[model samples]
Target: MFEKKVNIYNVFELRCKTTCYFGVGAIDKMRDISEYLSKRGMKKVIVVTDPVAYKVTGAWDVVTKYFNQFGIEYVLYDKVTPNPTVEQIDEATKLGKEFGAQVVFGIGGGSPIDTAKSVAVLLEYEGKTGAELYEGKFTPEKAKPIIAINTTHGTGTEVDRFAVASILEKEYKPAIAYDCIYPLFSIDDPQLMVTLPYKQTLYTTIDALNHITEASTTLARNPYSILLAKETVRLIATYLPQALSNPNDLNARYWLLYASAIAGISFDNGLLHFTHALEHPLSAVKPDLAHGLGLAMLLPAVVKEIYPFVAEILAEVYEPIVPGLEGKPGEAEKIAKGIEDWLFNMGITEKLESVGFNEGHVEKLTELAMTTPSLGLLLSVAPIKAEKEVIARIYRNSLKRM
Candidate 1:
């Protein structure tokens, strides 16, 4: 068991290994990017993405042209969705196998980039689907060389070891093999996210916000992670509204993108919390609501209820951002409440029913959320007891005008 009760005051050891490059037109750096990893007998390549990224980043055309120029044969799989499913992964794996593609390039936002991670693992054992990677059987050796290109500000899932693949209704199981970490490289160019729609601007920022803040207040929270989380929240709070207000402003978009990436790293350093664990099931079922929107709707309630449970951790997390509030009585609560209000202030909060979940589905949804493996990993920290009833409370609190 990785869980151990320890003094929360200890300085925790932080581990991170992904190489990240951030800039305005970093996509143009692709040729150099490809050469650094694609050297030593280039194998058949696959680019996993969606039509939106192809159109938005123009990376598909640009990259395909490069692959062709280098005389390295490649295939394109753009059928990825927001909450990528097993069927999609299976189909993508089949295409990769048919092409004999050994290198997978995930290009776009977290969705396609995340899908690319799942595809690389399952494609190694084509006919087996998510089965091969579900349990202890999956490993780095089973994965093809994967590369990530970021086109959005949310889900630094591009640089992390987590891949969420939906097998059925409102259900996603992560394909987590530690080797899944080395996806060759990640290319982050803020310009790609600049033209993104304002609605995406809002929701994806919510995702980043959850990643940073949740990791900060997570039970096994570390000081370094808390600091990053605080800075991340401040960055998102500072930049998201500006980007929303001015969609074409590259600098605003750049800062927001970097904040998202920082939050992603915070999670990679091991603080993904209950908000993500809960939000996945919401989107896995609704399909219509964007993942970011789902996070927007669910997080604040979790924040309100769970924040007090992890107050000491959260105090450290919020201190760097809110500064003056830590030592004073009631000030920490004030800061935490401010964080929640700021989420609302930035339009990151919404009614769950407005997105999809209604009273009709609450109990079962809550039941599954509590029992799912994701919850086990999350609750291992805080150990949310009165388990079934606590979920009931979360469901009721999440209720909005339907």
Candidate 2:
């Protein structure tokens, strides 16, 4: 048993903006969603999705079937790719504006859902570009309502208020968090997630784990964050391996999806620090690198450095997967190594070197992290102060596993 640290004196608030429908057969809620849109006179919807996931997961059939039945008019923007770019959001927004879209429906994982959040904002603030949105030039108070149809068990984008996008010209990736961007409705049906490829299954699960790890220990952490983080890690530890071994195991998928949602809500309130802030720069520099893979590579180094500041909370949060890590003040190195070895055994074996990053790239990556619009905010909440040297060291240590 482990004690979850909570300070009663700290002021904190918990809120969830999205109305989420979750479970094994939750995809059928699409019909109810369509009817609600119809009643609200939000019949013109633009769907943002990746080309592959929607069709392969049978979400396309279910969504379209309901849209047709409800007399909903929709346009498809299926070109969203991983690490979605400003160009993608602008293109989707243009199409939506032209089609007189009243609602934004994002289907698939983080990229498409995040793109939909940007598109929703852009459509409401007509004439604004994705670059401008991500650059923080506009502080949007409201946007067209978004409906997130999640097809993956990771990326709590379906239930959170944060969105990320890349500005390729400057090689910058930044995130935006707004009260208005939370999905008006969300559907998390594990049945739709059954077809997730093996690598994605692992990568997305890592992403959720990182979310809780950072959220539970950030300066903004509260009772809500710590409580949810513990449950999130326990669920992932138990269900992820089962889901990996039996892809069609709906029970495993359901719990993983549930975990992802709570993790998203946890971070929505508690916020994140090193892993997410640093990973953004890596993925920005190497667009092909999956976001979760970048975080996994950097996580151990981050844990090793910040463990002293957040030892008790993180130890409790990770105890489910990496046991007996509590109350060891001088065991940061051991704890980090344990996490690295566990992730490796779970199938994430490549290091920064495998992605072509080296000592030469560390300076550039650090600069990007410091200057990226909203990344600095995330860095500010880290338990350890992230000076250039500290940031550079983490990158260097991650070059190859210790």
Per-prediction TM-score: 0.87, 0.95
Model 2 Cα displacement at 186 (Å)?
Answer: 0.3
Pairs clashing in candidate 2? none
lDDT of 1 by residue, 1-402 (tens): 111243222322222456665667666667765666457666588888887776766666667666766667888888888777777777788888889887888987877877787778777764576544543354545678777888889887766777766656436444353655456667777777777887888888888878876777666667777777877776675677789888877767777877787788787775665677677667767766788887767665665566555666566555534555544434534654565566567665577766656788887777667665445676565424436666666667667521
TM-score: which candidate is best? 2
Model 2 lDDT vs. the true structure? Answer: 0.90
The parts of candidate 2 lying over 4 Å away from their true place are 1-15
Clashes of each: 3, 0
In the order shown, the candidates' Cα RMSDs to the true structure are 7.1, 5.1
Q: What stretches of model 1 exceed 4 Å from their correct place?
A: 1-16, 131-141, 169-177, 315-340, 383-386
lDDT for position 159 in model 1:
64
Among all windows of 10 consecutive residues in model 2, the one with the lowest summed lDDT is 6-15
User: Per-residue lDDT for 129 in model 2?
Assistant: 97
